[model samples]
Target: MSELYDDFKSIVLNKTPLIDVRAPVEFKKGAFLNSVNLPIMNDEERHEVGICYKNRGNAKAIELGHSLVSGYIKEQRIQAWSDFIDANPDALLYCFRGGQRSKISQEWLAERGKEIVRLKGGYKAFRSYLLRELEESTLHFKPIILGGRTGSGKTIELKKMSNAIDLEGLANHRGSSFGQKITPQTSQINFENNLTYELIQKLHDGFEHLVLEDEGRHIGNVFMPESFISLMAEAPLVILETPIEHRIEITLNEYVIEAQKMYECAGFENVLEAWQESIQSAMNRIKRRLGNQKHSEVCNIFEDAVQEQKKNGSYDKYRDWVEYLLREYYDPMYDYQIQKRSEKIVFRGNASEVHEYIKSVTLFSGRLK
Candidate 1:
């Protein structure tokens, strides 16, 4: 009998490679950050086998699975697994419940003179362990939320701190409709699991405090776990204050100039055109909030910027709408919200002062190096 491995901590800590032998559909729902889906059966085969199991029982289902996966199909899968094992020798293989699929995968690998360990309770057990850790990990750190208006450099300053977790980075979003990127955002499970890994690593490195952005429950479509969001809600907030002009510049660069560059880099046929459509869609999302009049003004300004960019390749024209939306739409909303949480404001300052204050607090507490 082969060893049944279940040291999930060591796996996560070591960044262990994982071979998920569950079908693609299962892997798509959720799996470890480090795990690759090299399934024993494809979705169709799994579906057929599932029906067989439901009707004919485990023995017949197992036989059907073998029959379906045999011949060149079996050879091809075994070779893929072998190649992965060669590259990631420390990798562990697993199925949904560490059951027949993983056992069969292991047996095949062994037949080819290759030995690989499979997880004891598999994906289900590992996922449960991670969720438990995610909830419990909140208790191990002191959280500080960095809050600011639309373009007040909250993410900019947050990244400077050694102890900060870039929630936006993890979610691949900037917490706005315009924040959607060229790449797809992570699935909710992937987001939580990635966060759990980050938290565990930080704790391992002896950091006792975590700094995060002042975001609502959802960032784009991904959201924080209830326990995690509860902690963030109660945590003290430090606001990063920047001059209005500077904030406009940051917003212009991030949403307009940088966004265009990203589209160009991704080889869009018409970079500005694609970016313009995206911005228009974002504006439409907040049409009700901006009201018809302000929304029309902002849209006109954006159209002017697009035309100006097309004419001279200058992004300076973007500032008008960017500033308009920041001052008119986002600023007042932020002000109202911040006023309600005035009691939680611990330190408010310019970026430099805010960074220094956090550094000092972290150092003084001796919780983080």
Candidate 2:
């Protein structure tokens, strides 16, 4: 009998390699941050097996699973697993509940003279542990929300500090309509996996305070973990300030110029047109909030900016629309939200000043030293 690993910290804190034996579809729905999917069954086989399990019984499902993965096909799968364990001497294998699939993989590997650890409760156990950890982090982490108007360099500042968790970075979003990157976002499960993994590591590292940008509940289509968001609302805030001209420059550089760069290398041409559509689409998300007249006006201003870029190939033309949206749309909404927060505003300063202040105040100070 092989040892089962139901211990949570033992698994997460260790660097031992893990082989995820869930189906590709299961892995795609959500997976650990460092895990690589080497599914025991692909989607179709898993689906048929699932139906058998539901309509018939465990014996029928097991028999059907065996039938689908026999002879050369079985050999191929085992060969892949053997190659992986060969490369990773200390690797562990896991299925959804650390059940039959992982055990079967172990038995086959043993036949091939390979012995590997089996994660006792598998992916489900690990996932439950992470959720518990995230909920606990709300209690452990002394969160400080870094508030700012658009283009305030909030994310940049967070990147410079060890204490901050860049939620926007994790979500691959900037928490705004124009914040979408050309790269596709992860599934919600993947997002939470990444976040919870980083979060618990930070908590374990003894960082007294965790800084994060002020984001609405959602980043793109993915939502922040509810517990973390609740903590953020009640926690203290430090707002960053930059001159309007500076903010406008940063916003255009990120949303327009850098966005153009992203889509260009994205292996897709007509990126300029894509950039325009992004701006228009982003504006559409706020149509109701911005009111009918303002929405139309903002879209028109945006169109005029793109036309200017077409004639002259200069992106500086976007400054007008960016400035308009910030002043007219985003700023008002931000103010309204801030007013509703129960936590006190702790400090307010520009990027340089706030970064310095954060360094001085945070427990992670001198960490780089």
Candidate 3:
């Protein structure tokens, strides 16, 4: 008999390699960062098995499954499992609910002299544990929000802190219209799972405070849990106050220069054309808010900037539209929102000063208490 392991905490903390034997479609719906999809049944096979199970009962379903997976197909799957076990000796196997699928995979591996353990209650059990831990984690740490205008380097500064959680980094977004990265944002389940894992690890590492960049409930398409969002709302705010010119430069580098490099590396045949189109699209998303006249003006400036960059390889012209959008669009919106939370403001300074201020404040002391 194969062993069934239920030590999900240890598995998560150590990032134990996992063979997910569910169907590929099931894996795509939600999965752990450490787990790889090595399905016992493909989508079509799983669908067939599911329909059989519903109509013909478990015994008949099992018989059909064995018939469908027998012979060379079974041998190929066993070989793949053996290869993975050979590379990751400590790896575990799992299915959706720690039932027949994982049991069969474990038994097959055992037949081939590879004794791998299966997760006791599988992915469902592990995911429940993680989400519970995430909810409870809020009690263990005080939150300090880093807030400022768009492009105020909140993400950059958050990365520099030992106790910070880079929510934007986890979401794979910068939290704005122009914030899309070269890679698509993570699925909502993935984002939440990764965030929960980070919280667990950070708390385990003895961090009593968590610093997060100020953001609404949503980061791109993924929203933070409401409990976590409520905690952040009441947390102390530390504003990093960079000058307008410096803010524009940071925005330009991230959105234009560095972004261009990313598109090029991702093998866009016409990098400039692709990137410019994305920028135009992003600006258009805010067209209603920017109002028609301002949108047209900013778009014209952007077009000129694109033309100049093409001709001279200079990004200086790009700054004009960036500054215009910042002054006219983002700043007013940011200021309006920040005003509502003025009572929560605790510290305000340039990057170095804010860093010093954060260092001096003890967790669960002063404003946090």
Candidate 4:
């Protein structure tokens, strides 16, 4: 009767103001875009009412709840509603499930002759709509995966592209232990929601190419949705190549200075122990590959390289050690993955050249074909 469908869709598109009628804790956990929490029941009251419903019955709980909220409190709520109306005359309100709470709130507002719209199915309906839209949108826009070994600057190149979706950026992680960021990572659910939102924005914008960094299923604590992952594997790819020196420079620029400072500030004794434990098996393989004397030398070299990185302002010395690790560990794994992938190696050059080449290609062609 209130043009609920049209109003809800407009709000979903962020064309209308959203007012959430759930408690603060529920809102903190998650909420729809642009929605602000304005609770009808305070935390303690909600808990008490819920407990009464469980112990006594619904009728008694309702009676007790009404008794707890005095006439003065109701007047205060009306005043709050007046304030909200003054601020947002055409606001849309929703509760958890479009149940008694939202209906009551809507009726109360309407009694004051205020124009307000109630979400038909409330938060649950909004969540279901987002999930369905995400699923449907993935089928329409294909992704172009960017693959390379660690430190290849694939992520940086992806950012340079006019049309790109950064899963790692959305997750607030760089896809590895070494990929830590300044800000705390989002909850996995939030990450998925953000990714879905980004996908929708990109698809609706009518971008011909959607360039994304090559990532495994998980980026630290957050895992990409299976729909996006399957879409990634099925899409074409553009692989960039850079020399070991260039790769090491990029990796060191990203990780070493920050990691060193973090280690110094936090004390790396624990980190050193953890690092030793995590890479012990891999180090053993490296040790066996080289004879005892050379293995000893390699260990000294590795330690010296780390020490040098700590002392020198530059990261050039660490290149050899990182390259050795990549050759021994990361390269073989990447090679195996590349063999299985149906990717096109578009450009193979140093970091600068590769960036330039990608720019030219995308600018001239107007897409990554």
Tens digit of per-residue lDDT, candidate 2, span 21-116: 889988888887657788788999999999999999899999999899889989998988889888887678899998999998888888988888
- The digit string of per-residue lDDT tens for model 1 on 1-369 reads 456998888888999999999999999888897899999999999999999999999999999999999999999999999999999998899999998999999999999999899999999899888999999998899998999889998888877777889999999998986899998888899899899998888888778778999988899999889998899889999989999999999999899888888999999998878888898999999999989999999999989988898899888888998899998899888899999989999998999999888888788653554
The better-scoring model by TM-score among 1 and 4 is 1
Local distance difference test values of all predictions, in order: 0.90, 0.83, 0.90, 0.69
lDDT of 3 by residue, 299-356 (tens): 9999999999999999999999889989999999999999999999999999999988
> Where in model 3 is the C-alpha error above 4 Å?
363-369
Residue 201 displacement in candidate 4 (angstroms): 1.4
TM-score of each: 0.95, 0.91, 0.94, 0.68
Model 2 has an lDDT value of 0.83
Compute the lDDT of residue 167 as modeled in candidate 2.
Answer: 86
Q: Which is the leading candidate under TM-score?
A: 1
* Ranked candidates, highest TM-score first: 1, 3, 2, 4
Task: Write candidate 4's Cα lDDT for 143-231 as tens digits.
Answer: 66777888888888777766788888888887854465545676776676566666666665566557788888899778878887888
Clashing residue pairs in all predictions, respectively, total 0, 1, 0, 0
Off by over 4 Å in 4: 1-21, 33-45, 62-92, 101-118, 180-184, 258-328, 342-369
How many backbone clashes are present in model 1?
Answer: 0
Overall local distance difference test of candidate 1: 0.90
